[model samples]
Target: MTEDEALELLIPGVKSKKLSLEDERKSKDLVKMLGYLPLAIDQVRGFLTEAGYATSIDKYVDVFEKHKEKVIKPVGVVPNAMVQRSNLYTTFELSLAPFVEAGNEPALRILMLGAFFGLAPIDEAIFLEYRKVQPAEARPAMPAQDPWDQIRFRRTVLSLAEQSLVKLHSQQDRFAYSLHPMIREWLRLRVDTNPRSVITWRPWT
Candidate 1:
């Protein structure tokens, strides 16, 4: 998206209140900070619209600057990649920060595991099937409900979808999901840095 397009997306249906010049400038700064990626822009829209957020665009940008590096690391950069992976990392890190702060580890784990499933449309049943074969004792611990359960799993996936981290698709009557190829590469880059996790999950992938 162009900067103007991204700004429009950042604030849709805003006839109710006019933004100050400073606010408009901050909005443009945010759009550029998000690297003009539509997915990142949409995720920022969702974050800003949440009732619990209770902050102005400038303040959110201030907070984002302070804490972005703490959330996700940039790695495995290559020349001529289609999108700006570093900016996506920062944007995605911001999206997941709330969940991380609230100790929603299950959502985090499910996200990481999905990256191993390749860049294809992931059938939701894969999680269930994996859970069925792996003993409960062998499964990784979840801070809350076992996300492997169909109901809990779907909810987690929906949460991820809302953040624009995963794209939800309905195939026939069933659910499947996909990630943008750049996003998938970023996720795999994340996994590559965590050796223990790679060892535990590689065979299954």
Candidate 2:
């Protein structure tokens, strides 16, 4: 996003006023370091706003830079789950924590499966088929006699979409989904560190 766009997003509902030269420079530098990504920008804005540091964009930048190297490190390669310690990574994790805490394993499994696929639109049927063959432990709490049950599957997918972990697409009468690039990277790091996570990259034929 351009400086103007980032400014508008960061300071919503504010009247137009000329920023002091120093503030302008700090805003630009902050946006650049945020990679122009809306998610990260919004998180930073929220953090600053909540902490009464909205006017201290430069200070936030300093804090961001302090952890910048750690944030850029490959996930799962680092020990102790500290990969999530960075602000941006923590933002994503907080978005995901509710589902895990709720024992929504089906939704998490669907997310993990999508992450295993590249960050591209995946056919919804892929998840359904995978669920069908997965062992009892891997399946959601659907009717045991109904191997083709879709109630739980659809619910889980929609829940994931609501969380912004995946984007839903419609084509003709069918549906597909894609994960955000940052989310894919986070999941990849999780899979790398988690030896027990089930993931496969083979195209569904």
Residue 1 of model 1 has an lDDT of: 80
Query: Best TM-score goes to which candidate?
Result: 1
Q: Write the per-residue lDDT of candidate 1 for residues 1-205, one digit (tens) a residue.
A: 8787898888885434587888788888889877888988888887887635487787878877675554343443542353466667667767877777787766777677666677778887776676667765565532234545677767877888887878998767688888877677666766543544432222112
Return the TM-score for each candidate structure.
0.77, 0.56
Please tell me which predicted candidate would have the highest lDDT against the true structure. 1
User: Model 2 TM-score?
Assistant: 0.56
Candidate 1 Cα errors over 4 Å, as ranges? 15-17, 51-53, 69-83, 141-148, 192-205
Clashing pairs in 1: none
Off by over 4 Å in 2: 7-35, 41-87, 131-146, 192-205
Shift of residue 53 alpha carbon in model 2, Å: 17
